[model samples]
Target chain A: MNLFQYVRPAEQKTAIAAVAAEPTARFLGGGTNLLDLMKRHIMQPEKLVDVTRLPLKGITQQGNIIRIGALTRNTEIAEDKTILQNLPLLAMAINAGASAQIRNMATTGGNLLQRTRCPYFYDTAMPCNKREPGTGCGALEGFNRMHAIFGFSDKCIAVNPSDMNVALRALDATVVVNGPKGERKIPIADFHRLPGDTPEKDTNLDKNELITAVTIPISPFSKNAYYLKVRDRNSYAFALVSVAAALNMDGNTIKEARLAMGGVAHKPWRLTDAETFLKSKTATEENFQQAAQIAFQGAKAFKHNQYKLKLGPNTIVQALSVASGLKSV
Target chain B: MNEQEPFCPNESRRSFLKKSTVITAVALTPAAAINAANNHWDEHIAAAIENVSLSVEINGTRHTMDIDPRTSLLDLLRENLHLTGTKKGCDYGQCGACTVHVNGERVLSCLTLAATTDGSKVTTIEGLANGDELHPMQAAFIKHDGFQCGYCTPGQIMSAVACIREGHASSRDQIREYMSGNICRCGAYPNIVDAIEEVQKGGQKV
Candidate 1:
């Protein structure tokens, strides 16, 4: 849209080399989000290395883990037999994202690389610290209904809009990346960064980096996992507050628990405190309510997102109840 | 093992088979005529689009076009190519206003780049008809009155064609879920679902 050059490389190596050669170049995946942002001039890349055609699409199960290729469509990932059986929570999270057509076109890698849907980030006329450091954060004093409630700085308050990343983090997935340096794998929790001092940096990934695949270790707890997303609309919108929960119940007591919150923090919020408290505890409504409170203990809320503080715990309780194979409280 | 069955001459059986074949062939003449007419329409179109070199097979017929890559597949068919049946609503993917089959899969023609789909088959609303006759789904839509504005008819029809093809026309809930991407701002969803149900009831054929 900006009169840029395009290349559809048949191989990933050539595509990587092309991106490395060009200073202002970006890899194009499904183009659902990237192209839209680029057309708005929010993202300006001189070259678009079309990696959609490169043979990087599939979902495979190796032993107790599931490996998802970077270019696998969200719909495909959500509908994969293995994912549906072993990682039902991940599949459910993928299904909870965008509409069918968008999901059909959006890739796993593209979903991970999706920029914040912050109104300030989209509007070039406004000053966004994420778009331009030291400019200002228009969202801080402006409309911040969709902004983060925790792990945010004064410079940026936008919440990460992914539904699958939360489930991936809870399942302790690994993000495999490839670049000029070499290939390396990072834990999914460390894949994204919080808006600490540098709000502009969304992830530790360098500009030249390319995500190859995401490997998820299968957990016995995941068999009972569930993902619940609460949004203003029934479909085609980002989550207001969502929870990914997996719990193992031995009769009435919680054997183990994995929980993560979305739309409440700069990145996926893993509830280690609540999970630690839930282990070996009686899986009752009272226990779930107490655990939910523990999950929200350290949460810092803004004026607009204080509703999430209440909704966050309620969402966690409901998700945990469902994951524990119990009725909603 | 009966002597009468053995005595039944092979000549009579051959004659009966021949007569049935003739009758069946005669009954299929109208459909054959429609197919021939469609072929004639394609050739006539080829004569008009001399400069357009697009090797696209629509509903199954190859045509080479020497046209603008900036011209969207919807525009190429409706405006330049004179297949003005695929309606253009929003010119964006969100509205599902220009949905069509690209390589047997439903895609928003408005958002799709024409150059990127080189050598791909495309199907438009016009291709769904059999000469003067309509496809079963089209007849069902008319019978059930699936549109009010009639502006979103082409896209609705195209999406419906894909809906049936993609095996999503099983239940009312399934139809609603699959057709959620295609919007009829005229608020004719109930009748649209009724039409889809009617066609799907008789075992829809694409």
Candidate 2:
């Protein structure tokens, strides 16, 4: 790690100003990913503006929406009574992502902005277009078992490694960002960008913008939602092909549905087609299987990750079954 | 100003002043120096070690010291404060060997920067015991034989204490899931779970 100046801005204005003034400055949330990347010499921010102290730690419900402050820790979000009752899918997805220790240290904003867990990005010796644009992508031709199978660019095949983002995308959440200009709300679907030619830019957030909160609208999928993750280990591992399924059922028929997948693409891969297909359909194994097939319409797999073609659908079917009460949790 | 007496034996006074000016500029403000370094200012490497004042309370004892901003909480505890019980396994967040409590929440000390923890309270493995008396979690670990090589026991016990307190220890599966952060190469997971279960069942305050 390199020696850098540390600034803890108590006010949001101060924090935003500090980040805007310095091109090499980064906002420190939980410091789980940023610090790890710093120790690996992957990112060398000249100054770390610690925003943990900013007044953005609230988790409240305003009528039909649940607003989660950007600095709220993952553990708190997972165990909060309101979230557990209203957004159980988000709680489950967050709980399934990391261990308790990490959950304690990781904030909602930090989790959403977390970089890829691609090995090539971690190892500076290797070439990663995301880590260093024009360096060439090592995972495209190298050991890419964890690489993406959807929305992959020729420059990068890395997957977004956040379970919480997938749930947020499915919930149709909105990200509240504060910047030099003012505040703006970005729909969660457009928050994270696919690895196009510019894989360096993870989210749609501008350099001067700082995430303040995330708001999710009240929905009927509260009671019937599941976050199913299949990993190498049962816990404390990134998802290989995780599914976040939520169904608003009209008795036996699906009134509405939301589906998103992790470990599949550069961003949270929302299954808009699958979600549309699931509406008005009977919540059964066959319908879920058909929806899963629709979800993988344009999914292109790498050499080592071809198994995701099978596992992805299976996980989706299982998640749908669990969420719809067809299968036991 | 002293042209006759050179600061260095071989260097000229004018060159020495130029070098000293650069060093002084870097020492006074590191952001400019970092910018210079980013632009390949290799000569100012000596002035890059920026020191920051940190006031932290550890194990109920408060210490105010100047530390390099790059120093991790784990390194500060083990190297600076001599609290070595908090082991460093992977030196990254992957291994829980550096697990410690920050404001009563278990966090990987290795990933936590000392500068970021200013005015915060931390509890390490060394602080588990109350003078002569062992914490219930520590005693339970001993009674249940929760470790073999004992390298990862400190982190396991710390995490177990947190897991129980956080209400994640209601069942064996939950304990396993919560304590998954601490990896035991010796495979003493069953015994570790037993320790946590006994402590949770005993109703002793952790």
Candidate 3:
């Protein structure tokens, strides 16, 4: 890692100003991903503004709404009583994402901002458009079994590796960020952007903006929600095709459904069409299969990931079955 | 102690400190060990090394040192303080061989910046034993034969102790899930689970 200047600003405005002053400056949260990137010489920042010591480190509730500080560690969010009781899908997704050690050290904002686990992106020897624009995407023709199947442009096909972001997207969370211009609220859907021409930009966040907290509402789908992560290993592995399925059931019928998928798109792929199809339908395997089919309508698989076409629908069906309590979790 | 001169090479000093610190690290506080590192050294090894002031307590010994802003906690423990008990496996947080307790929570020291650990209490494998008496978790590992090569033992033991304390060791599955951070290339997972169970059975000892 390059020797850089470190600053721990006590105030939020100071932190924002510090990053804005230096074009190569970055806000360091837990430094799990940033430090690793620095070690590999992927990201060389001149100044790192440590945000861990700031006053953004807790989970608060107002009535039925919960506000999670961006600095709140993933372990704390997973183990929080209110989160477990109200938004259980978020907790389950957080647990299914990374190992206990990483979850213990990684923060909420850092997890959302984590780079993709694409091998080409990590290997500096390879040509990665995300790492360096106009370098050509190596993952396009290389080993792309883990690449994206939705919302992918020709520039890049890397999928977002954040389980927390998928759950947040499914839960209808809003991200609150502070910048030099002013504080603004960004909906969870718009927080992360697809890889258009600028594959370097992962989210819609400005370089000067600092993520403060995320707000998730206590929805009716809390009672029946499940995060099903399909991976090579049972634990500590990135998702192959995971689903965050939640259902608001009215007896044997579904009142509403919230569905978002990970490891299949540039961003969290929210299955809004499948969700609409599942509304008012009886909780059955046939209906779930139809909904899964609807979710995969435009999903196009790469050369090595043809199996995802089959596995994706199966996972969606299984996750829906588990969320509606038709199958045991 | 002049590092720029030809007489005081870093290797000889490091070897002497390693040989001499076997007793001082345990018999006395390891503050002197770091002091020896500070008193005889060259901080200007590279042009990029901008020394940052950091005050951290490791193994119950408080030591203030001027470290490079790029220095990781694992590098500081092994290279500066000569605390090599915490092994470096992958060094990129992929392997948990650098596991240590930061503020009583199990974290990958390789990923943690030493400068960020200011005013924080860190515990390594060297601090698990009390005098000659081994910690209950350490003893349980031996009794259950939790390791074969012992390369990943330190990280596994540290993570195991934390798993039991965090109330995540209630069942064998829970132990496996919580201890998933530590990877044993030797595949001693079943025995490690047994060791954790024994330590969990014997309450308030870890």
Candidate 4:
């Protein structure tokens, strides 16, 4: 392992300055993902600024929305009463990710920044555009089952592997970033970027910019939300496919709907087309089937991930139906 | 940067010196003091970039060390201080192999840097034994055959203790959920659950 300097800045300014001074410097949160990547040489920083000690480590409520600090542990959020009651989708999403021990150590921000578990990305020996752009994407042909289906360029096919972000996108949450320019907000849906031509850039946040907090908008919509994750294992595994849906029904007609998908795109895919189609439609089996089909309208699929084209819609429909108190076939 | 109360060093060399002044006078005869100072420096330079002083109370014992800022609590314990009971399975927090108690709450030691845990109470597997007696959870693991190969046992035990503390030991499902982090590839989960259940039930079978 390469040796590096470590600084535990007592103040946030000093920590930011440390990163600004050395662009290769990284802020260490729970180190659940960062240290692992560092050990694998997937990420190597010349300096590590310990950010766990910073005062940005709490979950607070502003009106009906819950603003979670970047440093708040996944375990804390999963167990918080406010999150469980108001945003059960967030709680369910957090619980589905990682294991209990990992949840105890992983911070909210780290989860958002988690890299894909694509074998090609992790094994530097393999050609992965996400890991090293223009090298070519090996997973485009090899083991492409777990790769992306919606936002795939010729260069990369790796999916954005975050259940929490998928849930946040559906709820229309916003990320508060503190960077060289000071405080700014990015809607969660726009926080992560698609792999348009450069798969290397996973997010819009520059290298020096730090995610300060994630603020979910105040809404009663989340009260009827559900996060459904389908994976190979019952525990300690990443999602093969997952859905986050918030459905509000009036009698039998859908009053409102928000849907987002995971394990299917470069970033969380919010099915806005499906939402618009379902708004005034009855929440019956036929209407749900049509809306579900609308969600996957322009989703381009790879050879192996064609199954996700079906699984994605089915997963969303199942979650939405359950949340809407309708029978899921 | 602010002054948090530093815990007095436990019954190690520092505490021994603190308790017995007459013994320290004889024990710190030139050669011993020089050797003691050297040992201190060796521990301090484990990661060796900046001298980060910390007071961590392990088990019931307080230990003061000037650790390297890069030192993880797991590395500080296993690599530098020789508390090897906490295993480093994945080195990542994905596996619960390096679980330990931070202020009586279960935390992944591998993810925690020693500097971040300054003045916090840490309890490792080595500290779970009281002199010649083992902690009830430790004894339960042995009785129930909770391990085969024994790589993840220490972490499993540490997590089990925390599970009981966190009140998840009563239900089978909750125990499974809470202990889901610690994976035993050998598939000894049944025995591990049995052990945790025994410990939760007052550590003695009726």
Question: What is every candidate's C-alpha DockQ against the true complex, given to 2 decimals?
Answer: 0.04, 0.34, 0.26, 0.23
Pairs of residues at least 3 apart in sequence or in different chains that clash in candidate 4: none
Worst 10 residues of 1 chain A by lDDT: A1-10
The DockQ value obtained for model 4 is 0.23
**lDDT (Cα atoms) of all candidates against the true structure:** 0.77, 0.88, 0.88, 0.79
- Order the numbered candidates by DockQ, best leading: 2, 3, 4, 1
Fraction of true inter-chain Cα contacts (below 8 Å) kept per model? 0.05, 0.66, 0.57, 0.42
Could you give candidate 4's per-residue lDDT for residues A1-329 as a string of tens digits? 33445666767677778788775778888787777777677876767777776778788897777899998889898888878878888888888888777777788888888875577988889998887878988987798888787877888878888888888898888888887778789998778988878888888887777788998865666657788998887777878889988887777778899888889888988889999999988877778788889888888877787888888888877888887778642
Cα RMSD (angstroms) for every candidate in the order listed: 16.1, 6.7, 9.2, 8.3
Model 3 earns a TM-score of 0.91
Clashing residue pairs found in predicted model 1: B52-B65, B52-B66, B53-B64, B53-B65, B53-B66, B54-B64, B54-B65
TM-score of each: 0.82, 0.93, 0.91, 0.87
Residue lDDT tens for model 4, B94-199 = 6798999887778889878777777778889988887998888998899999999999999999999889877778977778878998989899999999888878
TM-score of chain A of each: 0.97, 0.99, 0.99, 0.96
Q: Which candidate would rank higher by TM-score, 2 or 3?
A: 2
Model 3 has an lDDT value of 0.88
Error of model 2, residue B171, in angstroms: 0.8
Off by over 4 Å in 2: B1-29, B35-49
Q: Report how far off residue A7 is in candidate 3 (Å).
A: 1.1
Model 1 lDDT per residue over A173-269, tens place: 9999999999999898898998877888888888888898999988887567889999996666689999999987778778899999889888888
Q: TM-score of the second chain in each model?
A: 0.70, 0.82, 0.77, 0.74
- Can you write out model 1's per-residue Cα lDDT over B80-115, one digit (the tens) per residue? 677777778766466777777777667777656453
The complex in candidate 2 yields a DockQ of 0.34
**Winner by lDDT between candidate 3 and candidate 1:** 3
